[model samples]
Structures are given as C-alpha cells and as structure tokens.
Target chain A: MDIILSNSSDQPFYQQIKSQIKQAILRGTLREGELLPSIRNLANELQVSVLTIRRVYSELESEGFISSHTGRGTFVSTIDSELIRESMRHLVEQDLQKVIQDAKAYDISQAEIIDMIRVLFEEDL
Target chain B: MSTVLTVKQLQKSFGSFELHDISFDIPKGCITGLIGVDGSGKSTLIKCLISLIRRDSGQVEFWGMSIDDAEQEIKNRVGLVMEGNNFYDNLTLHETKELIENAYPNWNEMIFQKYWGCRDYHYSSRTLLSSLSQKEKLIFSISLALAHNTDLLILDEPFCGFDPVDCSEILVMLREYIQDENHSILISSPSGMEISSIVDSFIMLDDGELVFHMDKDHLLESHMLIKGATSLLGNIPVSEFIKLDIGNYGFTGICNDYNKIKPYCADLDLTVERTNIADIMMAYMWRRGNVI
Candidate 1:
C-alpha cells in the first residue's frame, strides 16, 4: 500500500496514517488477509516512530478492519459490508452538517439548503 | 512494550552543572531523541547512560538487569556512536577497525567492508580518521555501529557539523537499521528540527531537569501557537497561555493544551496554529524563565 505524509499539515501524524490506511481498505486497494508492514518497517519507511505505527495498528484492529498475530505480523481483516456502509454514511453526514452550517452562516433558508442538497444528490446519481 | 534500557533518577554534578533526577526509558523498536540546548545536560546524561561518566546516584537497567550485573552484556549489546574520533589519531580506518574487531564478538568483516564503500565517504581503509572531515568522522563512527550486531545504538550530537543532505543521509541510515522490532536507538541533539521528523518520541531538557517528554503525535496535537490582537488577551484567562508574549503590533504565544482551550479559542474567534517540535520545546523554555 502507498501512503503520503505532510509535516506541516494541521492533522496529527498518527491520524494521518490511520486515515490513509482506513481509506485504502475501504476503497478496496488493500485485500483482506494481506499481511501489513511490520511496525518497525513501516515506521522506518515513513520516518515515523514505531510507537506511532503501533498505535495505528491498534486503532485499526479495534475498529475491526485489521488484526495482529503475536509472532507473525499484522494483516487486514475481513471487513463487514454493514460497517463499510455505516462508515461512509457517517462521513457524508459530517460533510452535510458542514454544508448546512455554512448555508446557515450565509443566510440561506433551511428549505433552500435542502433544495440545493436535493439537486446535488440527483446530480451525483 | 519491551524496554531495552531504563535510567531511573540518574544524577550527575560538575561544579555548577548538575543533572537532576532524570528518568526515562528506551523502549525497544523505537527511536527516541533527547533534545536540549547546550549546557542543558544532554551530553552529561548520555555520558552517564553509557557509563563514561559515572552517575552520582541512580539505577541504570537493561533488559531488567541492573548496570552492575549487566555491564559486560550491555557493552556487548549496545553500540555507541559519538561525533568524535576517540581512537588513535594516527591509526588508519582499516587499522582502527581491526583493533576493535575483537571487542565486538559478533563483528562481521563483510559488513564492515559493505559500509566502507559508502558514496562520497572514501573510507578506502588506508585514510587516517584524524584527516577526515566532521561529516566523514561521523559516517565512520556510525558505520562501526552498523558493523556490530548491536541491538541498541546510542548517539550523541551526530548532526553537529554537516550539510542538510549529509544530515538526512545519516537519518535515513539510522532509520533503516531499526527496521526490526528487536532493535532500538537513543540519540541526543540540540537541533530538534533536524531529527524531529525521524524520532518517534522526544524528551526535552532545560537547565538540568527534563522539562517534558512526549510522543511525537501527542506533542503536536496537545499544544498550539495562538496569535491575536494584544487587546484580545483580556478576554482569555492569564493562565491559559503557557508563555504569552505581547508586541506593539499584536500578541503571539502558545496555548499549552489545544483541547482545553479549543472552546475558548472558538468563543473569542482566535486562531490556534499547530505546534512544531522546535516551537513546543521553545515554549517550555520560555515558561521556565517565564519571560519571552
């Protein structure tokens, strides 16, 4: 898998790593049961600390997107379709909330904001 | 986490300079950096850790074994690379390597030969170490570390005299060495910006005390630089900013905890910028003197 990091970005480094891996898994770029990079290897590759990578793996495992074997290594887990859908819905809901907030800030009416969303939704299909 | 080395309440004194009750762990599989300005006890602490200068008091342990019990084992397993030529000034590179070969039982002739040909290093073996430049000296020192089958590497001020490219070259080499979870490294340097990108955790020192220690991500996430008009300072709590500085144009300072002041920042329409390692350490330094 490929990953990119920016030191100057506002986001924390660990969060950047976690999100990139999650996105890759969700987008089907990474296959289930595929062995992931060892914590030290990944840390070296990214020029980050092994602790940070360990935290990333732990977070992924807790989210059920990956799992680790004691002596072997970490691997992607079989993801649930329901979880994928729920995660996507949650992301979109957050975006929609921001859109609503911006609309309200710009003095747009609730009905007008809903109408705009409807138009955008139809266009997306 | 499995700790490779633990220094508990390590203390040392030399007239006016004293390292006061410093304790930290070098966990396996991680690169830990000690950052402090000159005379901040970075070198003293490292000297004590390696037993070059005995600590006045405190316990140093490796693999749960005390220093007294594991001195030989620790010497065998831990490699030290300082940016200086403590070897005989007249000895050639090959001669020096030959002398130290028996000291490290696991030393490989082939591994030594591999690093001997580093690009632009000209470690042709016949060249005397005393004639080498600062950068070459450091490269040779680190190459020696790599040649041994050491699990833990200790470095002190290895980035002092080098171009940016050379500094990065050293950083990359160190990173590649710890690709396995069995190895660890502890490095000390005054230039936080140079090694901060590669270090997993950071320990900050000022005067003789450890001002703070933190994970890289946590340090960046916890604090931020807050800037606004000096007049706006009245709206926020005096204690909110760790080291507040006011200017005629405006005011700029650091908020110690971004999470705690996020709502306060929002309520006052203030901007909180992400803190860099250098700035974070500087903020603490400012707090110590309580003046900027």
Candidate 2:
C-alpha cells in the first residue's frame, strides 16, 4: 500500500499515520491478520522518527485496528464487520450532511433532496 | 533512552581554529544527525569523539563509561567513515576488508559478504578500490563499518557525491542496522535536508557553535514560514522569527512562535505556509546574510 505524507496537513505526523492505517483497515485494503511492516521499517520508509511510528502503533492497537507481538512484528487486527459498517455509515452521513446543508442553502426542499438521493442511487446501478 | 556517546563542554584549539564547548548526546537506537557547513568543526568533533585529536578539557563518555576508562574498548566498536573514503587506493575489496579485520575483534567475514556481494555489487575479489565507482566505494566503506560488530556508525558526508539511488540505499541500510536494538548512528552532513528523513533528530553547528538541536517531527511542528510584505515584519517583534529573508517585493520569514503569530496573521497581507526540513535549514544557514 502507498502511504503518502503531506507536509501541508495540519494533523500531527503520528495522527496522520493512524488515520491512514485505520482507513485502510476500514476499506479492507489491509486485510485482517495481514502482517504490517515493522515499525522501524515504516519509519525509515516515511523518513519519520521511530517514536512517531511507535506512537502510531500503540494508538492503533488501543483502537483495535492493529495488533503487535513483541519481536514478531505488528499485524492488522481481525475486526467485526458490524463496527466497520457503523464507521462506514458515519462517513456517508458526513458527506450527506454536507450535501443537505448546501442544498438547503440553495433553498432546496427536503423532498427535493430525498428525490435527488434516489436518482443518484438509481444512477449508480 | 541510553546514551551511546556524549560530549560535555568539549574544547579544543589548533592555533588558528577552535572548537568551543561542543556538546550533545547520541542515544542508543536513535539516528542523530549533525549539520553544519564545511570547516564548522563537524570533523573535529568526530575526531574528538574517536579521540584522534586530544581535547583540551571536557568529558567524553561512551555508553556512560568515561572515555579514558574505555577508549581502547570503545574504538573497537565505533565505526568511522572519515574524509577521502580513506581506503588504500590500490587495495582490492578483499584486501581492504583484511586490513579492517585486524583492528576490530568482532569483524565477521560473513557480515561483510552479506552487504558486499548480495546487494547488487558484482566485483572480482581482485578489483581494486580505485577502480570502483564513487557509489561502490561508499558502499564498500559502509560494509566494513557494518561487518565489524560496530555498535555506533559515524558517517561524515560519505554520500556527498553519491547518486540518489545510492544515497537511499545507504539510508535504508543504516535504518535497518539501527533496527537492531544495540546499534545507533551519528552522521554529519553540511546539508541537513539530505538526511532529514533518515535522521531521528539533529544538532546544527554554526561556525563551531551549537545553534539548534531537535527531533525532526517536532522541528516541523514548532515553526512555520510566512511570505508577505516586509512592512508586516515591522509590526512583529524581531525575536519572534528565527530566520528571515527580505527583498524589494516582500519577505519570507520563519517564525518559531507560530501559534503566537497566527492571530496577527489574519489581518496581515501575507500567507502562512507549511515548511519542510530543507527550507528550515536554508533559512537558518542564511538567517542574517545577504537579504532575500
């Protein structure tokens, strides 16, 4: 997987790493139980401090997105789809909220917004 | 957290040039970069660290043991890549390894072979050092450093003239080595940005004086650069900025106290920009030189 870090991001370096890995897990780009690159290796690849990678690993472990075995290295944690579905739905809700806000600002009614969503869903098929 | 090497109040003089109170620590398992222009006492500090030149006064500690107490033992474990790639000009790859093997008790032929032949370096055992490419010479020097059971690898611009691929190879190898808990590296280069991604932290030496020392990530977070009219700076305190470049059109300055200045920026005719290590180094090096 390609993990690109941008200097322009306001997020702290470690936080950026955590979010990327979490997104990967949620999207299934990183499979359950798949071995992750060693922390030092990732740190070296990203040109970041080892401590930063360590912080990312620890935070990911705490959130159940990843797991680590001493000396054996880190791996993506096996996750329940119910939790991932909830996360994915929340993400969709955020996008829908933005669209609804914009539509309301344009004086579009709730019925019109619902009809637009229906049309968009049909277009996807 | 354990310090592998540290210099405290290190002072040395050579009639015309002097190193004044140079001090810092290289922690175990961390890569600490030294940055300064040439002749900025970087080589002198490395020599002092290895005790090649005697210091007038100050303490040099190796793994928490006094230098005098462990100098000989320490020499065996500290690997050095000094100027000139210093291998005998006509010696073959094997011949050079044979030479380094005598000085280091832990020198392993197997270790040398791993980095040597397996890393895309195809060579005849009789191939002379002078015949190898510049990149090849650097790899050879580092292979010796790695093979000798060296705990601390000290590099001084060994990759200066190397190609991008070779430089990245060197960085990757060093990081891989440091992944082993007992190894650490202290590397120095005139251009800090070249190794910013590779180094865990850095110490900047300016004309023989320690100017800045910090972890790389924190360095990025602690400061920001803003480009705008020079008149804007007149309203801000001079001390607010660590470096500046002023010109006819405007000025671009790095402010360490970025958070404090953020509120004031909203009303100013300027844009605050995210910065990288290279930009930071340039501003510091040219902080007060020719304007703009």
Candidate 3:
C-alpha cells in the first residue's frame, strides 16, 4: 500500500505500518471491508519480518481499525461515521496538546500561539 | 510460510574436514546468511543444497518436495552465483545475457536493462567475458542472476571483487530484490563483516559443524569480550562460557548468559566489552585458544 520505512524514525517499523494503514483508511484509500494482504505477503512486500507485519495487524485489529477472519483474510473494519469523526477529533486534540506544550515551553503569548495555529490551520485547509 | 529448503542431518565430507549432522530451516521469503571462515564447510553445505555433490545421508527438501524428486522445479526457482565467473570465456556480456535469458522462464529483459543503466558498467553485450575486469565480471554475473527472477538466490561470495562503492550498490540492489519477501537469499561468504548488517539471520559454521543458527542480534547479545588482568581470568567463572580465548591483553569468549558472566566478571574486577561477530566466531573456532 505504498508504505515506506524510515530507519531513523522514533516510531518502530510495525507502528509505522499501522499508522500508514490507519491514514489510508481515513483517507478512503482503503475502503471498509477491503481485504488487506496477509501477514506473510505484506512482510514480503515490505521486506520486513512476518513478525513485524503480524504486530502491525494485531495492533490495528485491537484498535478497531481492522478485523481478521480466519482463512478469509484481514479486512478494514467498518466504522460508524460518528465514531470515525470522534477518533479523528481525538487525534487532532492529541496533536493540539503537543502544540500547546511547545507554545508554553517557548513562552509564546496567547496571541502568538493563536496566530501560529491560524497559519497552520490555513495551510492544512 | 512453508519450508522452501530443509536439510536433515546433512553430512558432507571433504578430504580433511567434514560437515557433521547439519540441520537447519530456510523458511520461504527469509534471507538466511551462511557465515563461516575459509574452508569451514560453507561451500560444502551449499553444494549439498544445490545437489552438486552427494550428501553422505540426509533429507533435503525444496518447496514442499524432496530435492531429489523436484530437481527441475528447484533449479528453475534457484539462481546461484559462485566465486568465479563460470560463464563461457569467449562470450560477450550481450551473448551471456542472451544465453541466460533463454534458460530461465522468468527472465526480465527490462529489469536487466535497468540494472545496466543504473551502474556505469558499460560492457558490450558483445564484450567477451575474458576481456572484462574481475569486478565487471562479478557485476555482470549478479546482473544476470537477478534478471532470472528466481525465487531463491544462492550467492557464494558475490562481493569478492567489489570495492566499497560497488559493494554498497550491490547491497542496495539485494535489499530491493528481497522486497517480494517470497524471494529468499542464501548467501555464503567469508566477508561476513560487510553483509552481516543487512542479513536477517546468521548460520555460523565452525570446523565443519553448525556452531550457531540464530538471529544476528541474539548472537551479539549473548556473547561478550571480557578483558582484564590475566590473574582475574581465573577468578571469573568458566562454566558459563561456550568458548574462551586468552589473548595477550586479556581474554574473550562466547557465554551462554552474558548477565551471569557480567556479575562474575564484576566480582573479579574485570570489564566486559560487547563482542563483535568476528570475535565470537574466532572464540568458537579457536576453542578458547588465542585466535589472533
């Protein structure tokens, strides 16, 4: 699914895979109930250990982003629209928290922080 | 995830050295590095894998079928590059490519062209193999091997003639080749120091015996090179060691439990250093005697 690994990244390889899959699902690139490649296939495609891919799939499944059916294959789990929105909001809040912490650490004024947020929000938009 | 290659009690006897009761798994899509020093039965074991030489007594399986039964299927999937350029001396690079292209069903002409394009290696498909430099010959062989689209690439000392830049380039290519994960590589090389970083696991042979078959990380974690006063060596517990070598400076060894050895060494006021792969190999080969 066009996922690439960064050896220098703080996130482990499996986490990188999980995060990319989640992003793909959120972006509608990976449709709900779409079958994902088997652990072995994915591992082979990514040139990583099957154990690494297994960890990624397990974590994604546990997080309710995917589901696995024995012999059928792993598929992107269907999520309620409300739940998807809530999860996306939570992710954004977590990112905002980091920004707030950085702002405080930098001794930025509330106005400066607001201005920075506005610029970032506009750029993202 | 089926076993592509399995060797059960595989024994191969040379004039002076013999591989004794060798057994291992080469799982589908996994690159297993066959590591050993010169004349340590790496070549002998590979010959047995390829069925070039007769094994004393053992089972060899390739792709769910016995090696003897499925010779053609195994040969189709397997691509081998040994030390020397075994190509016809009179054949140019182009002729060599055409020859190998006709042999393998899955040969990719575009991929072959791309490989040549990526490197500054300009040899006339017509340039005779004898005219090419050693490095060029090795590169040509590798290019041809990769073009075969074999599921398994068994490379024996493919890096022999490569300089650092060329070696790195080859490593990059190998890394990309294994992207299919279904494609596995069984590489036997004395130059373990170069490829060890890229390999998934190591199969170390010593004195015609399987010394270790485990992940590279685990081997590094398990072994240590403890150096201290020669008197402190005796003070440390010897039972925990697999092998030990007393050097002029101090001593180094492969220990089963590094934690246990660390405490014992600490008690004796000795420092334990993290052992390199070469040191661990040397310790096992020399059986605790001075290797260097």
What would the TM-scores of all predictions be? 0.93, 0.81, 0.69
Give lDDT: candidate 2, residue B273. 73
lDDT of 3 by residue, A1-125 (tens): 57987643434566778788988898899999999987756765665555567778988888788999987989999988886897789778878898888888789888998898799989999
The candidate that wins on TM-score is: 1
Per-candidate TM-score, chain A: 0.88, 0.76, 0.83
Q: Alpha carbon lDDT of residue B2, candidate 3?
A: 73
Error of 3 at B160 (Å): 2.1
Can you list the residue pairs that collide in candidate 1? none
Q: Model 3 off-target regions past 4 Å?
A: A1-125, B117-121, B228-236, B245-252, B262-270, B288-292
True contacts kept of each: 0.69, 0.75, 0.03
lDDT of 1 by residue, B1-292 (tens): 8899888998889899999999888788888889988889898888788788889999999888887777888887888886465778899877877778878888876656665554435556578878887776777777787677778888988888668998997787787777767888888888588888788889988988998878876777777788888888888775867778889988888877777776677667777777678787788888888336
Better model by lDDT: candidate 2 vs candidate 3:
2
Q: Pick the candidate with the highest DockQ.
A: 1
When sorted by DockQ, best at the front, the candidate numbers are 1, 2, 3
> What are the candidates' interface root-mean-square deviations?
2.1, 1.4, 5.8
Please give, for residues B42-63, the per-residue lDDT of candidate 2 as tens digits. Answer: 8988888788889888999998
Candidate 2 lDDT over residue span A1-125, tens digit each: 67888777756688788778888889889999999998767888888987788888998898777889987889998887887887779778978998998997799999999998899999999
Task: Give the TM-score (vs. native) of candidate 3.
Answer: 0.69
